[model samples]
Target: MSGAGNGFPVPDERQLDLERLDLERLARLRAQLVAHDCAAGLFYDPTNIRYATGTSNMQVYGLHNPCRYVFVPAEGPTVLFDFAGCAHLSAGRSAVGEVRPAVSWYHFIVGERVAEKAALWAEEIAELMARHGGGERRLAVDRLDPAGLRALEARGIAVADGQEVANQARKIKTPQEVLAVRAAVDGCETAIGRMAAALAPGITEQALWSHLHQANIELGGEWIETRLLTSGPRTNPWYQECSGRVIEAGDIVAFDTDLIGLHGYSADLSRTWVAGERPAGDAQRRLYAAAFEQVTRNIPLFRPGVSFGEIAARAQRPPERYRGLPGAALAHGIGLCNEYPLIVDPSAWEAGGVEGRVEAGMVFCVEAFAGEPGGREGVKLEQQILVTETGPELLSARLDETLL
Candidate 1:
């Protein structure tokens, strides 16, 4: 856990201050709720729940099931509605005041009784709101089904967009949160190094990608959010997941590690490498140089006070042949997941762009991809960056020197 075989240091979990991290996150959420003039906030997204409570249970499972949630009053202690018999998961967390069995009304769980179950769920939540809302009925909900929404509305409760509140609250990271991000990136870079070392001819792309998964888990990281490892012909088009095709010598292998690492923080970094220690082809070199240049140039534009549109306007773009290729952005915000503040390609700015200023404590993923219109291979390069008061700090600095 301390260091990988490739000599990259893996952070020790004991060094993180979990309590301060948890409390600060909760405080941020509460402040956002108060600013939005909401009496309480209801969270169904596992990422939002984790941000507000610092506890998790069946994170992936909870995402699709919608059987777990948490309630946070603007000024009171938070309560977690956990999965059946799973209340014990938050036993030692000070941010969570109470744990109760959740009411699950999803069709898969309730069948013909969805409405009944939803009504029951609404009654409990309404009772809590009455007691803790200080006579206010405004409830911000991250996500809910139509039935659940109707059930709450029938009781005269006003529903607001809780996802926006959560995102704005999470936009700025505390100092403790930054430390957590650094640790996740350390573990992720170590895993990436391991994956690169295992690259060889005759290995299937899937087989090679598994090294990253294994190393991440062995280092106490959670799940990977994507399977974007491809080689040679599969590398073009860029969104192809890892397959069983055997990689031959000199094939360009490209991958994006959309890894959710330690403490549920993401370490999203991408790289391309040539197999078997062979020199890259002329086309490969050109593609890689373009991607490398784009990432390096865009990263420095993430200084504090810079607007997202400004960054997009000033970003380095790929060549004309590589323009409009799918599956990557100029830059994006990264946290427990790919959160907010996406800086898109300038060409698409008029339609898909958003307005926001880059601020200190915000982390971003700067990305670039270079693949010719009819080429058989491509290069994808990305770097994780932390925006500080002075400038941008590169979090994942492990680049493939040979490929570059």
Candidate 2:
């Protein structure tokens, strides 16, 4: 959209080869299918479908309505079952080979005939496996209705965890994927600048949050995953969606830009700032400093070859007063969406932690939240990082100096 004033150069779309990206992503998914020993992958989740085929149509709508899906064979052509009459959408895409009308079996669509539709859907899938599965009946499916699963099982098809295959495939970013991520972050930060410039006393939280949405849409970005902008006391307990509460002078406005930017990549970054020109008070500064330190301290621990547990063990904790509240993750992988390898605090690691190693091509968002127990204010800070062979590279480099 506008010039890159956020230090990172604006991504040149000319440099992005969509066909190459599609091929690379398809190869990655196939590799994962081979590793998982599945003959094919049946992707119903729109994100996984986009990853495997690079063809998108009504992504959010496709999420809940299983009206669209793709059949990706481990060693054959990709067949897209598009929404009725929407097969034209995948035309000219090298990643997609055949396009057919989808058989939707969701309750909203088929009502009492769900079983009938699911049977039809399963038959086609079984036929595809017979034709291209090389005698393997195992299929990896990301998401499916219970009826659909039962119907497939009736046909002797074995289903495996397809989400795992998709996640593992999406974990390592190709060089082109990294470039796409850079473009997304650049667009997201530009939108963040717009939102920040609009912050002032008397502005409703919803109104302020809309600036980020408007700027993202104007820049060809898709959608924001959450409305996380909050001000004043609302910022204390995190995860409060933006509302009509009018911001006051010196109020702390904290938000996470779970922005899905250009090319369907995500730029999940967060920041907190004081509302008005009135300088931040002592409590505000202390919260901001702690949150800032937590993010900055944890970022360096994310070099290649490090274990997820090691990162959590060595992560910097907030002051004792602020330790009562913790965000969902200390660091998590970022790709098409917040995908895998959710690193958490040591206290909660036993339950929510994942087993994984930091690879050079992976990207992550290091997170921090500092809000004293019963305090009126809090600070949320996050940074997007790309793991290099040597160490972490800060992708979201424009931190608020005034608040810091």
Q: Which residue pairs show backbone clashes in model 2?
A: none
Candidate 2 to truth, TM: 0.97
Q: Quote the lDDT for 268 in model 2.
A: 96
Taken over the whole model, the C-alpha lDDT of each candidate is 0.90, 0.90
lDDT for model 2, please.
0.90
lDDT of 2 by residue, 259-323 (tens): 98889999999989898899999899999989888888889999999999899889998888898
Listed per candidate, the RMSD to the true structure in angstroms reads 1.3, 1.8
lDDT of 2 at 61: 87
Q: How displaced is residue 254 in candidate 1, in Å? A: 0.4
Please list all clashing residue pairs in model 1, or write none if there are none. none
> 13 in model 2: Cα distance from truth in Å?
2.4
